[model samples]
Target: MDLYARFDLPPPPPPTVFSRDHTDGRARMPNFASVDEVSKFVDASRLWRHSRGANDFLRFGTAYLLVISLLVAAGILHKIYKRSFWVFRIVPRGHSNILIPNVHNSWALFITPYLWILAASSIAHIIGDARNEPVVNISLWISIMWSPTLFAVWYQAWGLIAARLGDGSASFEELPGHSLTKSMPSWLINAVFLLLPVVPSVAASLVGAIGNAHLEHARYGWYDWHTKYDGTPELTRDMVLDAQNIFHESIRGAYHVCISQAIWGMMCFLFGTAHSFATSSLIFSIGDHLQAKRRAVLAQKPRIIPQALPTHAPVIDRSLPQISQSDFSFKWRTADEAISKPLPSITCDSMSTDNQHSRIETRMYTFGQRMHDQHISFFPAIKSSSTIVRIEASKAERVLNFFIIQSVSIMLGTVALISDSLYMALHSYAAAEANNYESAFITGYIAVVIITLLAGTGSFISSTHTTFEASFTALLYARRFDPGSSDISSSGGERTDFLNME
Candidate 1:
């Protein structure tokens, strides 16, 4: 139910050829020697249950301060609770990859950086509150933490990208997913994949946060960090003026040029943004495409019909010598034996004692005849199979990514423009009423950002959602499923277990 769990899955793997994903991994796909062997993995009905989906109780409870109450309860009940009081899980959906090592560890260990960032951010916020400078503290923290956080997010949830690399089954199908051109080498794609995150990570580290710090120090309380380190950058006068000038230009005179332009670097998202793509939405789209895919998989699932040998079992105790004495015989023949004569099976009715070919031999001849009649042949045709490619991120992919960057740039610029317009409106009203300007620009732009963030998050998620063990012991528990109640429903028939996953 929490907003963050989807992004909390494991990091995406380095780019690999399509083949290595299924066949080359250390884990072995189940091998079936017979129908019975394959049946071992099949379920009587789908084993997936709705409650088995991703549940980030840590994030959910912490979001509402419910964790505080949970902590108190856990302190009291620590003796009786031998099992975990809570669980957070992300089930592999459709054919999405998970547990590649084929083992689940403590979720805390599995996603270490997630907790690291959480602690870092919480401490930053606490420091901000302590300093009575929430704005400055947050601005600096976001800047310093931006790069690591980006890595952490991917480290946690990148595997979702793997799902888009191929169709759920072996063969590649691109209608609902992304596949870079075959000409693109996997090394190139790996390079691109590696470089994409670095773009924003470096950008955020360079300007987004540092710019805020420079602007705060220059225009507000001037501090020279040369004599002693104050933990802030040792920005030169030129750097301060430059950061201030560029930032003010971004503000678009909404702050009355000289004084009002400082709202804690509110427009600081200029050069740095996450390396997400419109492709990601298309990749993570939770619309009809995912539902359609699920339906297709279920519809295509192989139906197993139990087959049995004849109820009247065959008695086959006939000795080879006894059979040899009769018209029928079992003998190891060398090439010399067949050099001058047709084999018994090929000699008309002599292949069988009943003056006919055996059942298998007859079936083969009949199949050949049917094939000839139908003009059907498979020897010359290729069946569906997997292809391995190390792909480079395409020019098309780069173009799309750049496209999103421009779009975000325009969106932020538009937000600035609209904020300025509202400020003008407020300025006019204040002049007419002979009252205060009421800080309309700051309040107005922030409201716009909140509304935009809400809308974007909603649309984005109509798209994505990943797991582990150093197990997080839940301080409290919430049960949404009850076996005593026969209110069970299948996420099958329509969708799949992936959908049933929380």
Candidate 2:
């Protein structure tokens, strides 16, 4: 108590003076009236804080959803178009030639869907501001939407390279009809398909990184609009507060959008990769089967050759005449004059022997039929029976194997898509419950990725199957007909002779 009383000095205070000689160049300090003045001054200069608004987040979410839905619709339409029964047509050329009519170009099939998705998404983005809830964050939505198209582009480019490297055509129509084994170029096609899905995922990661950088800048004071003060007039406190709220809301919306976009991008990449892998595997299996067919054909080495033979008949003489030596000489001279110097030395036995030997040689060397003893014989029946069995077995195996593999690939792709959708649904539910809108937006993006990946996988599988079928048909046709031979001759000669011979 005594110390407090001495230090407090309530009633009066004394001032001390210093001599200039003793004080070494010291300056006097200013005194504050009270601690309250310092506190009030500090409080006056400090920035005000406000709650983040929800309007901008709502706008972004609305836009994102609207755009994505349109994209989904477009994708569905594309699927319908591809699966339509009217897409294929058979065009007949004369009595012998048949062609499958192709309505749209290959590039059209690949590009049109992407274009539709892009257009629809763009429109949705433009109209988003008016909707109650925006589709998604605009920036994120755009990034996710662009992935499939970008993947397609990459796929196409890689496909071209692979085709060139394999010395094959780049068209989807060029794929093997049966198995990868049968089509020498099928592996290359599968490889290209497999490679395509990676591009979109990588692009997504890059975009995410960029978005994060922007987010960081925003987090700091770098882009803070509230900090800018012009000489014309300072913003009122309310205006400043409002601006800050708007900025925060915008940031939140953007962050949610980016998160959603990134998740979508990742899903797409994964789906695409999985699909490509599955399709490629199927293609390889088909190729292998086809190769087996080729090998079987090669091993058989069946040959066909025309048979030339002469008909034989017994000779019979009913009448004979006897002549004297003088008569004989007169008859010979008369015969020589009548038959234009007479036929030179008629040797029936010699001619007969030569013909028999030639026929024997032909029969011995030929692979198919042999006609001997005035009867069609053993070799023809054996050859024909073997050929029929081989053709039937080959065709059945190829078609069955290809169809099974393709079906499996399709099923797998579909299941993957479904799984992705389910996961998204769960994530969405969690986000909603937690009031974590950003997580919910990302969850919704899974649908886009799944759809795109499924589309690509389905297309590849279908195309591969088509290719196998075409190849098998081509092979069958080649085996059945001679490439060097004509079905119809140019000359107006009767086809009866050809028909009879066949």
Candidate 3:
């Protein structure tokens, strides 16, 4: 009322307005009708930008590192590091290995480079960051994902091979299943499993040691301290203090690197253990299915029992066949049995009493039971394929292995965190004076947090997926080869539910 009275001016347009790009370029206004709408708009814009930034950064860094490593490995390093380091070579067109196949070679193509990048990058970044240098870039940091990726590739390549071996043929359908190292003895399997974690753990430790050495060299100059501080205790106190500080920082930095290595190595070992279990399951399933198929084939075959002696044959009477059986209770006889009989049938008087008939039935049942037991004893494979399915499909082993890996990783992370916290707390005054050690500790703490979270998710998802796929494959094979078992279908349903729980 005041504005209208003051000057006959039109009300100003709402803030939520935009011009439409059209033939007329007309202005359009939306009703910001409710607070929800405004909030939604703001949220959408903010989230989109945030997601885009993170995605772009990761994408750019990964590609940059991958390309650079590939160029160096394939173009430059290939000539120098022939067998010692460069073990992979790209197959020329139409020249791929028949046994290994191109898919594997292609996978190794990417994975080998990634491994190289990871091994190099971890050392470089840890050393640089420890020394408080700006040498390590964002791209190198992002490439820390190399170890997990390596685990995945290693699992896949070996898993596929194991599975195919279980299937006993190179059919496309059987190309990607798992199997136990069946040909190997039990001792070999145990030995390999036990030794799986050692190599990577050792390598990580060595790398950490080298990085620590580098840190110490960088931290402490190569001059005689006694000469620099002049031998007097009072004059040398500050120098001695700095030396102690440098040594302490070097140890801390090295410890951080070692923890990271141990974490990744443990992860690799976890996958290795999972691979062994899955392979064993697959082999068990394959064995069951094959045995079932063999039994079914054998069962269908016509068995010819030796012709019994004349006295052993069932008595038959062709004469007075009109009666079909005389007082013989008129039991029907097959045409072949009637014709083969050596003697005529007995009369009604020869028919056995009811008690005798019961005794005979009991004898027949006992004989059949004895034969059944003997069959199972002779062919242990006669057990239902459903049991095999159940054993192979259980996710318990995979889950247990995963929890072990997770527990170990968490413990390492906690130790690293505690050590860093203690170091910072005890040297708070000196750290503040220098201002570098505190930052290093904080950085290490942050790294531990990020790595712990990533490792947890990566290990769980990858290991679960591998276990599920291998088990599912075994189930399919079991069902296909052992169609008589209704239990297989039910077990398959249970497996689906169990995987959903994971």
Candidate 4:
């Protein structure tokens, strides 16, 4: 039942995987030995700081925001007209820009909305942190989380974009043991996410948005909403009290701005993490599909996999195959040796032709240098390495990586559910004894419920992602399009042989 047994490699490495510091280039800081070493380290540190100044960091940070917004705006335009699209070649790498593959709900397309949510939530965070308003001090901190969070996502995104559009193809997977993206976690950004629950009630922030968040239990909060009512209408009298009571008793005014925005930010972040993780998982994502095709090429044998709506090609009325639950369970049922050996990496490229017969192409690719066993992993560990078939994400791998990710989501969901239950139980007593508090309780409650849904949905999708992918992968490995087979469907001109990548 051990997933690692099926592979040619060992089990997933532990979270605290320790190996030699394989950082190349002697340009790094010197270890403390003598005063000279300390001086040398200090000098190197300053150089790094000077090279990547604050302004540069801010520019990169803001640039990413603008790029996401522009993508969303352009998608709206393309979706409406379908043909009135103009590809803005920021750094056009010959004809590759024109051949951008049309994947089924590419992350590049949907990612915009998630970023928008983060931006919206960030506004509330920034508002809460504005010292000029009430002098609420910064009391929160988030560990930049380079391996799996901000740094991982950023460099991978950059690499994928750079490789896909710039070079040719890009492949990636999560490796908690591997190193890279270790610039320093920006204290400025980290501190901004941490804001005082109220003036003078600020508590010091811990790692990763864990601070004294202004959740609904503040002693006092300023209410910011007002509506002129022609004397409290008789019918609306009790309802008004209940709504106000809901803010104080249910969520407290703190939940309205601070807590909800933070939750929104958390949920969006997980969504982004899921996108990056999907590259290695066998989910129903475009990247996964492309990966499936790549695996088929490396398949010592042919395979038959479930297919989704095609990309860029004409809409097909015919469904090629469907991955049943039994098929998915087969992978997790036990690591089947029949399962195809995944490549170290696969680079997928999308090319649109000028003629009507345009189709996504998978050109042959070869990895440069393969990391051998016993060698320490270091910066840019994403190089030609692979994880367990994420579609068939083994128990070994998810036991740590996926479990941790899902646990965070589950924990948030459980807490929110519990909070609501307690609020309901205490609402009447608190409302009866209430005097005055002007917090957006109803609005906050709505946001709270939405946040719960976000967490729940995110967890469900990730949990099922491996299942769906594993099942689809199982079906493909067992049966593929062969002209000799009776049950196999037509290939629809899709290539079966791919050399590493395109």
Candidate 5:
């Protein structure tokens, strides 16, 4: 039968009570008036009084197991710490002085206090359970679990800010789309970063609740006898056989519920991981595209000239000129005499030589003119708006904006995750108590530890990647916009003469 069907409500019943009279002097007591009477009698009887007894031993036992698991996980985190420590030391030596204040760093400031809270909560829960007392309750756990989701929302806002800063185009405001800057109002953006982690954390909490409910139903059936006793009791063959069918049905229902809860929790984990990876990948891809475009522009060579100029004069004007001294006394030779007396027979070969020399002189003169034109220096117009000082100032403003937003997000996320983990751990134990199933509590504890460790590791990796990418992008932009200072020459006269001759 379906689990929902099993939950069908039963018809109302009349009340009655059980009474034993010694007047009959019989060894056996008389039965109750009705089913209601029997149930009421059972409810009122001291036989089920042990149900109120606190299972302190079970609580402490599970708490200790969780602590040990955390210790083992801490060792894994330690290895990461050692590696990161070295990187932190080395990066500063080569890194630029401009440090983007990332919120991830703030985790260091509050991590100790956060860990203490978690440890204290766990211990309190264990001690309370050992003494049959309630430590942290469900309301507190729900609040804790939801914290991380809030942090994720906060981080998303930071990402938006970073996106706006890294945007290359100056007309971001005029672009034909909703601008990241304009569309996301300051309050709304901050709210989103504040609320992001809440979704996954809430999902996890819901799943955990379902798991607890399932365990509660299972323990009620399996340990129904023990609920009223300190230990397992032996039943007669007939009684045990009679209870087997109901027990099996309850167990099956509980198993189904627990499985569903597990699936739900797994979904939350997968979703969170996917979001983190997608965000990081997008940032990386955009940065790479920009860098590639810059490189392509820089690699192109300016157009080049192919050949050198030759040194020679043309002969077109070289022949002697006939002068008449203002058309008076000077005699000029006749055309026939000049032609016949062409000192050496002006042969085709000679003419060819004269043509070649003329071509050479023309080429040299043209080259010199080209060189002289190139030598004229025009000062590039100084537009204050396009100056390096203005550009750098703008970049600095953007960087500061991005850093402030991103850092807030990181800190919030870290706190939320840690708090949620602690809450879940305690909640799991509570669920186990409600069900009187030791295994359920143990399994839940293990799951919480595993999830916490995974989240911490994920955060650490994501922060590192974001940091590196941001640094690389900053370096790229710096090189592009600021291309360093150049030296100027002082010898002006010599330079001018060289230019005129060229």
Candidate 6:
């Protein structure tokens, strides 16, 4: 007590320099513990936030879906208009005798659908961006066009089923006339295919919702508009206290809206499908009408009548006196001479020519009979026999062909997905390093363009290959099933009339 009184000062206060426990009147800034932590927080608010990535993904995914859908739609339409119907016939090289128009329809098949898809997708994209709509909203609109595209896919599947049931023939008699609803397998039509077209839209919507949720959860403090001016006089404590009451009110609200987006997508998809179904049915009816008309015309052609004429006749020679150097004409034999002269017996060369003509006529009739027997008079390239064994063999061949093409598609899809991911990563890294985000995005866009071009090229090649393969397979089937038919032989060598559309 005596020593404390002598010192006359309290024990030295504890140092406030590195201690947060001090109760000092001086203001202290908030501590982040380390520079790295501050750097991480800043990055979260700017470059490394989950919301930013999610938004980018949404934009890219929507565009990609639109592009792919365009390609698929064009491909299906091309198959339906050109390959399935043979609306245009191939002409022989250097032989312009055919009266048919020479206009090429291939570009129409490619460009028309491209323009349609482009217009629809661009409109959706612009509207979504202008309105600041959610990803699911934009996707739902884009899916409207997707449903009609699937119609062609379903139509192709129907064609396949028709071919199988018809024993690899697509003739109106063998294929159903009512609609695709009748032609598709009951299980596939009622259950699988109908659901498949909706799956992509549903999956995308779900993914977008999940991504949005993740983005909201990982948001940083600095990103909050309230905390943005925390140190300034304009942000008062009382106001911040009041804002906390309503800040969390709408956090869960955005996610709940996804349900509505999903419903809208479903409705649009159904509408498009119904529209396509009706349109396709009408087209099928028209096709049936045209085929029936063609049959009637063929049946109405006049039959050629053969007359038995003497193969050889005595040569007529009448020498006339020359009236003038420039005006001299030969005289016909007199009626008496003509009546008196007996027709010479048919010579061996003339007889041989007659026999050859008879053989040709007999061969034509026999070929027609064989075509009827093969059940492919209407569909020339499709060859089917009365025996079930032959049909089964053809089915196996068709399966093999489809399997190979499907495998190629699967492989290409996988490669494209991986490539897209890798390119996106590259874009992100390059953009961050250069700190020129706009340029980076533009480069990414260029990459997408490249990818789309490559995809289009691949699709074109695959389609060409498939068309050729189908035609060739049909031809081979025809030859194997009807080897004796001279019609197929002559046309097969001279032209591509035997299309294996099956």
Of candidate 3, the 10-residue stretch with the lowest lDDT total is 356-365
What is the overall TM-score of model 3 with all chains considered together?
A: 0.26
lDDT of 1 by residue, 237-297 (tens): 3333332232232222212221222221222232112213322342233222323323332
Please give the lDDT score for candidate 6.
0.33
Ranking the candidates on TM-score from highest down gives: 5, 6, 1, 2, 3, 4
Q: What is the C-alpha lDDT of each candidate?
A: 0.27, 0.34, 0.34, 0.29, 0.32, 0.33
- RMSD values for the candidates in order, in angstroms, are 27.7, 26.7, 24.7, 27.2, 25.5, 20.8
TM-score per candidate:
0.30, 0.28, 0.26, 0.24, 0.34, 0.31
Displacement of residue 418 (Cα, Å) in model 6 is: 7.7
Task: Indicate the worst ten consecutive residues by lDDT in candidate 6.
Answer: 356-365
Error of 4 at 128 (Å): 24
Candidate 3 displacement at residue 43 in angstroms: 56
| Candidate 1: segments with Cα more than 4 A from true spot | 1-138, 144-158, 168-181, 216-308, 311-502
Off by over 4 Å in 5: 1-117, 125-139, 152-157, 169-274, 286-438, 454-502
The RMSD (Cα, Å) of candidate 6 is 20.8
Q: What tens digits encode model 2's per-residue C-alpha lDDT throughout 1-502?
A: 2312323322211111211122321111112233333222222211111113333433444454445445545543654565421221222122321112121122224434554554455444334434422333234334444555444434433332222211111223454453552354534534545555555556664665554443334333322433343231532433333333333333333443345454554564555455455335434543443444344333322221222233352343322222221121100010011112212223333232222111101011111111222112221111111111112334435554654554454445445544554454344323322223344443344344445444544434434453443333222112111212332336633121101100
For candidate 2, report its TM-score.
0.28
Candidate 3 lDDT by residue in tens digits, 302-415: 331223236755654433211111121112111011112123333331122221111100010111222232212211112212121223112433433443453344345434
> Which residue runs of candidate 6 sit more than 4 Å off their true CA positions?
1-192, 200-204, 213-410, 414-452, 461-502
Model 4 per-residue lDDT tens digits across residues 1-502: 2212322222221211111222331112112233343222222211112212432433443345555456555654654364322211122122211112211122233334444443343333344434212112111211111112222223223323323322112222233311332232334322322221121122111222332233221211222111222233332323232233323322222222233234334433553454344333322233343334334333312233334434655554543223332222112212211222222211121101110011122211211212123111211111222223323223323433443454456446545634543442233122212221112222233334355346635543544453432333222222122221222126322222211121
